[model samples]
Target: MKADYKNWMPKGMVTGTGCGTIASLVLFLILGVSPIVPEGSAKKVIGIVLLILTVIFCASTIWMYLMYRAFSYNGKRQMSKQIIEGVASYVSIPDGGKGLDVGCGSGALTIACAKKNPGASFTGIDRWGKEYASFSKKLCESNSEAEGVSNTSFMQGDACKLPFEDETFDAVTSNYVYHNIPSSDRQAILLETLRTLKKGGTFVIHDIMSKVKYGDMQAFVQKLKNMGYDDVKLIDTTSGMFMNKWESTWMGLSGSAILLGRK
Candidate 1:
């Protein structure tokens, strides 16, 4: 079984960054050559300013390229895939239990978990939003089949309102998804996911846990503990042992974290 998962970072991101850098450079060149600037201190200052802007954008474009390379690379060097597999390793589904993957982009995490826990059947759901138009239920199914995973299925569904009964899944997983949702109640989305988890069910949800996006995640974890969740922990995957500082900075995953617990 080969692992063929599309990266979470879109190719357009790199293209856009590169285009911005090019545009800035072109503007700088035009400013340098054109007769718009008078021959004085002002012209030198303007040239210096344009040069600085070009340098900043050029550096930004390079950083974006590095990020794209990190994700698109195959093999062990692919940090995003490694992180997904790392999160999947934390999941423990009982034999023949049903597992659910929320916002299973490209079915990477879902298929990875299914392969790890062959005894468990996995179902992945996503809205296949236009931002990620390449990712569809059919692509997910095909990716699972390509990875030789048979105990997995894919469906279209919304994350804010999952189409499943409460306590229906023995395990649930999601990665880098919730923050993308255009909603103010991010914690509610997490609770909605937890609602589908059966008693003793395990979950490993990874996403950017910036305090701005998910207010006081430590408090949130404590709230889970208060609710009787066992072994609940909020792991800082971005700067912790899973991902290094440079990787996080280059990939713009500085606030990535995993919330794991058993219901």
Candidate 2:
């Protein structure tokens, strides 16, 4: 059975936008061909505006499709796979030790990490909210089974308040998760994830991490260093790890980076 790591670009958005673009173009054509409106200055202006709207909608639809293709596992770019593999690389769980994956949609990263550390086990958790209704706990488990990753399990949980005790895991990681959460303090959410890692435990959390969404991440990294966390560094993925600067900017992931280190 092939695992389905759904595209980051929602299918509904692409289809809906494509339909609107088609409708706009059809209306423009009908109006131009048939004298549906009187030949006047106002009609001419309306036609121009309608044609502009059609162009805008058409462009949006094309962009969404391109993003979907890039993010798809079967597509040429396989961007999600690159990001997942990058995050999984930092996860090092000792034999008999456990690791945790927050917001583990599809469990792709969790499975990758688990397969890499066969001596250890992993738990993947997510809210499984309506926005990504298809990414349920069952889907994660099924993906693991299909991928032959028996060391991993999954459950539904809130990222803001993980159910496990403090310093419970050997390692912790997440990918492109926290930025989507509507938190006034995204740093707090990062801290929440870090709160569950054992002393000397490694972590890798990837996200858009723009100044507008995360605010002064440099200061936050300094705070972690001050608190004595080891090897704390933020690496820019857009510089070429997962995507280029131009791709990140066009895809609205301009500040994408990986925050990695040990607790």
- Which candidate number maximizes lDDT? 2
lDDT of 2 at 87: 85
In candidate 1, residue 2 scores what lDDT? 56
Write out the backbone clash pairs for model 2.
none
lDDT of 1 by residue, 1-263 (tens): 55457666677766776787788777767676577755777767777888888788788878767766777647356777787789899887878899999999789899989999999999999999888877888888888888888999999889999999999999999999999998877999999999999999998999988888888899999999999999999888866656788778766777899999999
State model 2's lDDT: 0.91
Q: Could you tell me the TM-score of candidate 2?
A: 0.93
Local distance difference test values of all predictions, in order: 0.86, 0.91
Q: What tens-digit string does per-residue lDDT give for candidate 2 at 94-154?
A: 8999899999988999999999999999999999888787788888888888898899989
Q: Candidate 2's error at 195, in angstroms?
A: 1.1
Shift in Å, residue 117, candidate 2? 1.0
